[model samples]
Target chain A: MTAAVPNAFDDPAYRQGVVELLGLLAYGEISAWERLAEDAKMAPTLAQEAEVAAMASAEWEHFAQLRDRLFALGEDPYAAMLPFQPIFQRFHARTQPEDFLEGLLKAYVGDGLAADFYREIAAFLDAETRELVLDTLSGTGHSEFVVDVIRDAIAEEPRVGGKLALWGRRFMGEALSQAQTVVAERDALTAVLVGNADRPGAVMDLTVIGRMLTRLTEAHTERMDKLGLAA
Target chain B: MTAAVPNAFDDPAYRQGVVELLGLLAYGEISAWERLAEDAKMAPTLAQEAEVAAMASAEWEHFAQLRDRLFALGEDPYAAMLPFQPIFQRFHARTQPEDFLEGLLKAYVGDGLAADFYREIAAFLDAETRELVLDTLSGTGHSEFVVDVIRDAIAEEPRVGGKLALWGRRFMGEALSQAQTVVAERDALTAVLVGNADRPGAVMDLTVIGRMLTRLTEAHTERMDKLGLAA
Candidate 1:
């Protein structure tokens, strides 16, 4: 891909596409923030609650960065964020965690999946926007803390491993279904992901998209295994 | 206060009391985080939701600070936080925000009252500990965002003012009662707040306690008025 240029943003459709991606991400962070905070209540200890809240708040910081980018692009940050709300809400409603461990697995697995997907999509974006999106996804925070907690939990209760492994599968399924729903609705966003002619970098073929999904799946399985869950 | 010396921590009882107080504040931040996030779901717009989440995340940052302080004192942060769980849970259960506006008022008024109460108590501590608590309580993140939203809502619907005012009163009553429950249960905490004979600063009597409550109440009223609600 050629180096990104300000001239790319000069194209109104390209600007709108980038704005849409940012908006999708901004709302995604808000939804993640709410879910993680809700899960914090399920934490068995204050430290764990703090850990989850910390991750949720970290996600909000990313939300702010995205929103700021929207403003810098001369767009309404909230309006940009509004359209994708239902998509994320639907995803969360379907994958609601049943317990602290389930919540941990969801956070760990869900975050990893989203990060992988975004990283894959970034390949089709202009360098600046790609960097912004990747940075936002970089550490949406449910990191080592969730992993340690989930591993310790499965070790203590072997039955938990089976349940969470099932939960992990369910989380992945609901997420993919929601992604399909969103892609079906958001023509502009889908075009950006699938590589529209004017959509920044090299256009992606069906094969590339397939490979991306495969990579995301492999990453999800690895994360699930690390949590002592059967993928 | 004689310049805070390392010797103060050398007094095991004082150290224990400080640890207890940090635990209370840490748990308090987590509770605030949960409530704000819950309230975020009630927000009428994505903007409002982000605002509430922003405040909740800020509270989590404070939780980290308090937790770090606990660790610095060689205490297990979660273990220290455990004992105060029920107290905050009881307080939250009683003062739950029924909707977005009520949650805004709670975040605004409740935060103000807690900040005032903590500031008053800080007067009884060694300089270092006083500074730490004061710093954590400094900007509880319920400032322009909550006040602006509440003011706008009440301006649009004056009747909400009356209900929120009453809600504010109930919030105060519940908070005080829960605090009383905590003080009655944790003698070390009470000693830290009211000042034990062998404690650092001057001992507080009933009159002083009454005055502290008065100060917190006055601050609450001011905040309520800012929110366009009567106290």
Candidate 2:
């Protein structure tokens, strides 16, 4: 199906969408950092406590960069971000991971999906916007330390695999639900990406998307298995 | 005041108090890092946001060090910290600064007074403990950015002096009041410091205490003036 393509920067709706998405993500990062830092206090060792706190703080740089890009796009960051509060808040409330492994799984799943989503959108944007989105998505090293922890934990507990695998499924399920809601409610924003691309239906390649998700799941499973979990 | 001096570390009451105070302060640092990471959202610029988050994260390291020291002294980190929660929580709640400058002011005042308090206690401890406390207090670069901000603000607005000066007063009043309360509630702890190698009273030297307070006040006033605030 043929779709109308528009210059993203010049489209007020697209620019506003950018602002909205960035603002919401920025706020999310700030809150995440706080929660992670506090949660670190539950750690049995001082070393782990410091590690979590530092990881929490590391999110701020990416949050700020995305925010700055939004501001530069002339969007009212807060206003654009307001529409996302309900769904985002609900996700957090529903998915408060009970254990350290669960928390790491949550991060691993969330960051991987987000990175994938943004990477897809980046392809449809102008060169400058594409670079910014790509940079923002890539710059935050969210998965490295998380993978390390999962690996170490699995090594210590070979039987932990099943619990973590179940946890991972739940985490992804919640995320998918959020994505569906966003798509259903945000046509203009979706249009900004899907309708803006030259190949039109190229954005709707289900096989490609499925492969990406499968790969992510596979990687996560491998990480858990390496840790001796029932992946 | 002819006060009987007690060997603080050896004295159960004093040792407990020391543990309690230090534990609270250590936990406070950890919480502060988390809060700052959260608060960095108020920053309008990404660079500034990252900087604040980094500082917040760094607090965890200090917290770990202090926690280790507390454990070394055979105290329950959480138990020692439980008593001062109300006072500390109240102070933080009342002084929730709205923006970056206010946040900086809070840090500056809190860190400065804490360092001074640590120095006072260091003198009464064993050489190793004293050295550890002093090193921890001195190594933290809490006020470096604050001084830069104050300098810049003063350069920008000459009339900001009065407002900041008042802020400084509020900070000091609250800190001093809490400190006095902590001290009054724990006479054995005071005996720990005052009773040392010399006569407890001679070791404390009320005149020296008065002089240190005066110097701190003067330094704060000078800072306010430099920040173009009324000193």
Candidate 3:
């Protein structure tokens, strides 16, 4: 390995952007942890409850790692994470699942979107920070578990699919609205994301961000489709 | 090391007892995880919330290890964990924390008692099972965290200490009631605990059980004292 500081470190604004992006992603994991822990309560069986709670616990480990990295970067992890909390709170408030299956869908669908967005943002960061961001967003293998349960339930009752499809659409709408609110408020994240229009090395633009959103939407739809729900 | 099977394996009843004990301990951890995860919602700060959630996650790791070991022993881990759910549900319902401090107290005081009891029970099993039980019962380093917050809160308002002391006593009473109920219901556990009064190698008697409870109470008092609360 070459003993060279990554290009991202050559610019202070880019460093700030990396920290802001990580803080936002870190808060996303923390909120996900809280939501899944709440969801565990509505699980129909102890074994199933353990499965859901296991996912929630995995989020905590990710959050701890992300928070530590944020601290290492000379940021107060909690303060850095503060701006994103209300965005999640608003999204969760609007999208509270009516039952256990809906909760699983949200856990699966919601995390899928967040993870995809974070993975995209990782591209603008230095190698180490990029790896840390990716590490924090890795799913806890609960995707299959969530899919199995939701698909089995939907198969057993075809009418339930219509109700969940509508719910999925509502979840997607709420998430995007809240995400736009976060992007509006967190200028550092916005800058790190699309970069300056005149910056020679800028890889992100309105076009790139638009394509990223499209990719994220495609992934979310795939997740919902796997659960036998329409996006 | 000798490949000794240990004395507990000589008797099928004792082996059943080991399984029973491990099952009970595993369920205790699983329940603790659920309760603490639920408790995380009441934390005043996100940092404190993560602290509580981290403890809950540690419990899941312990439960996973125990569950895998139970499967290795040709037992259905969930079935083994089933008998203790209602036991915990009853205790939690009776002692739901009214606020964040109360939740912290429950997390601390409740876990202290459970850990102490399990540590005592660890002595009666084969080496492997004994170690597994002990490992699961290890505290997630929450003692200092809980004590620091509770003591600080109480210091801010002296009257809060009195209220929490009463709550601690209530918690202790409810725990003992449920524990006796468990002792009454789980015959395999009972047989393993007291070692059959007529058996020549009987390791426990009414006297030993009495002493165990006494020691458990003393430990609980010390925990309460550490928090500057009355037992």
Candidate 4:
């Protein structure tokens, strides 16, 4: 089905959707970088701070890639990123971590959920766009760092796990709420996921989106469990 | 003199000084990254925020290089970075910018001053270590970005030049004060500047140190002039 249309950019609706998706992802990277850098401040040691700073740097690199892609498409990269700023600002403001542990959980669980959702959306995109989207979503290889820190924290103070589990749930809830708002407000991006009528071979019915959400949920659950937190 | 220090690393005093210098630099990079990221939040536009973030990422990259070099020298990178953390913390705390423009100027003027000081010291080191130190001190190619923004800002509001010029002086003063503290507290690093008797080729007299400080001040004055601020 994906092979049926080699030039998805030919469809205006598809182009708009792709641009919206790229912008959303680009802004998401910037927001991630900001949040991770903020979290680095709460790190207990210089080594841990450097670890988190490294993650923030990785996010900046991803943002650069997406921004360049938008520029190559002749879209003003900052203008492309503008529409989603308020949404991200609100998400971060509402989910301000109370402590270092909550911040770590948010980075791991929140980012994991967002990446899964974006990857799901990427599947409906043109091959070139899909590849770019997936590549950007490929996280900074610091998940194990986050996991180890969280697990060690929990092992030392058994009660800390419960608080983190709750924080994980809050992150998921905030993220999903924001995701719904994005879907409701961004018609072009929604069309990317639900399939635009004018964009042939891009048609995925409601069932597909439902299954996609389910997969995203299951993946989030798996990640939470890995961190010894209940989803 | 440079050719005579082929095995400078074998000298215990040289090694201690080298390690101390690297630690100072590594922490400085981390501190720079933190301050730049903080400044990014005050950016009026997303593009400007990204410009600042890019600078922060560049610092992180340099930090990685210094950290890896420390590791190769069999020093614990975090321990190497620890001694200078409080000094940087105080420097940043005292020079917190009041607004976006102040932030930009601080980053430009402050970093420029710090780089010049370090580069002057780098010249007295072993060739290989000197090269690494100098390479890390190279300004991220975003000076033009900072210069352009500040010039346009001053052009738009003539009064801004006066305020930023004062800010520039304050940055230089604060940096010098903290730097003096670093030199007084860190005997090994000071030893690097005032060569040890055992480290023959590394011997730099107090006269050279005085000239180095003069060169640093002259460079700072030139940078302020470039930014249309009185030194």
**Residue-level lDDT tens digits of model 3 in A96-189:** 9999988998888887887787777776667798788788777577888888887788889998899989999998888777767766676566
TM-score attained by model 4: 0.93
Per-candidate DockQ values are 0.78, 0.17, 0.77, 0.84
lDDT of candidate 4 over B119-146, digit per residue (tens): 7776678878888988887858788999
True-structure RMSD, every candidate? 3.2, 10.0, 2.6, 3.1
Candidate with better lDDT, 1 vs 3: 3
Error of 3 at B91 (Å): 0.5
| TM agreement with the true structure for every prediction | 0.91, 0.58, 0.93, 0.93
Docking class of 1: medium
Q: Give the residue spans of candidate 2 off by over 4 A.
A: A1-35, A38-210, A218-231, B1-14, B142-144, B150-161, B193-212
Candidate 4: interface RMSD in Å? 0.5
Which of 3 and 4 is the better model by DockQ? 4
| iRMSD (Å), candidate 2 | 5.6
Hey, what RMSD does candidate 3 come out at?
2.6
Highest-lDDT candidate: 4
Write the candidate numbers in order of decreasing TM-score: 4, 3, 1, 2
* Candidate 2 docking quality: incorrect, acceptable, medium or high: incorrect
For candidate 4, the clash count comes to 0
**Model 4: how far is A23 from its true place, Å?**
0.6
The model with the greater DockQ, 2 or 3, is: 3
User: Which residue pairs in candidate 3 have backbone atoms (N, alpha carbon, C) closer than 3 angstroms, thus clashing?
Assistant: none
Which portions of model 1 show Cα errors greater than 4 Å? Answer: A1-6, A140-142, A194-204, B1-6, B194-204
Model 3: CA > 4 A from native: A1-7, A195-204, B1-10, B195-204
lDDT of 3 by residue, B1-231 (tens): 456734556677776777777788788888888888888988889889888988888888888888889889899888988888888889999999999999999989887887898788766566787788788778577789999998998999999999999999999999888878877787667766654612646654567666778899899999999999999
